[model samples]
Target: MVKKKPTNKDDNLVAQNRKARHDYRVLQTYEAGIALTGTEIKSVRASRVNLKDGFAQIRDGQATLMNVHISEYEQGNQFNHDPLRNRKLLLHKQEIKRLAKETDKKGVTIVPLKMYLKKGFAKVLIGVAEGKHEYDKRETMKKRDQEREISRVLKHY
Candidate 1:
């Protein structure tokens, strides 16, 4: 039996960090290309990317993605990429400087939100975010609950 390959649109998304939305107030978003080894790319295409517990930082004038897990490819032997390796993110020089400056501000940080394929190349969606306070989190939950309740009532009517 021949295994079927996933279609372009269906296989675009590799992973997402849903918790980032709930825990941070997003200020801005940027798309960056990830540097991945051959085996890692295969693993990502197999839907083995994980964005939870991941963050980005600027070091030595470069942006690096840390703690994002890309599992080893099953068919790859000793050439498999490390699952926990810090990956480089490709960005323009000015963008990297800007991110570095912004992240230096109190309560601001860089976070990876999602990984997806664009034109067959892997790309990451990163956000400039501020950590949400406890009360702010509560307010977000309340708003969400109200929205849900309103939708339910409208559907019933």
Candidate 2:
């Protein structure tokens, strides 16, 4: 029996929204700090975050992350933060203002794409994305399939 070493370089990635790519055309991406309680931070460190339904919204000139589920910490008794609570995103005022202005345009919104820890600080990658239509999604799928087929043919040859 051979033992394997734990050498996952991308293990720091807490969560990713795979559907975001298929459903939206990303225009821009921004990294923002997340405000978390002690227990919430612990949960995030444990990779207990879900970005599938997460999104960012600007309100009163501030950005907030909503629908990001962070499971409760096991050791947390009564001090655990709410799993689905809206958490504030740390961004400069200028950036917030720009995001607010850009989000006002039709079909453009903020979506959380990935979450990870950078230098021990929890950070989220949010994107300004435009929603894709059904035909656009189909076209993307077709392109991906063609790429896969080409790779297979090359390998066989």
Candidate 3:
């Protein structure tokens, strides 16, 4: 029998952490599997999730994403999962070890970059990031302003 094509509902991007890019220097990225409930998945599909203040922790050989909120489903009834529950993130043993070592560095953190569905399963793109210093943030702002100014001048000319 021929294999059927996968559907897009399970492959769409539900939400993203746009602030992550601006606040940290992303050093490495890893795709991780997230354990989600039916209601939570539905809520994610509706784009009712937030990862702005979310973070991942390595605990007892597992990665858990905390503070990530997925709103309760409209018709979920009493079985709806907690909006801010800590969700398990699936990663390989070796990957988790690497992440643990990296996070041991001062100011390094595991930040969720985006959440999407792949092959009918929810996946999170996690980043090994280091927080940007004040000077670094100021430099980034200066560069952004310069680019905006150049764009404005070109448009007027």
Q: Highest TM-score among the candidates is held by which one?
A: 2
lDDT of 2: 0.93
Give the per-residue lDDT of model 3 (tens digit) for 72-146: 999999999889999999999999999999999999999999998877688899999999988999999999999
- Which lDDT values do the candidates have, in the order given? 0.93, 0.93, 0.92
Q: Which candidate, 1 or 2, would have the higher TM-score against the true structure? A: 2
Candidate 2: clashing residue pairs, number: 0
Question: Any runs in candidate 3 off by more than 4 Å, and if so which?
Answer: 1-11, 147-157
What is candidate 1's lDDT per residue for 21-47, written digit by digit as tens? 999999999999999999999998888
The TM-score of candidate 3 is 0.86
Q: Ranking by lDDT, best first? A: 1, 2, 3
Alpha-carbon deviation at 33 in model 3, angstroms: 1.0
Residue 22 C-alpha lDDT in model 2: 89
lDDT of model 1, residue 145: 99
TM-score of each: 0.90, 0.90, 0.86
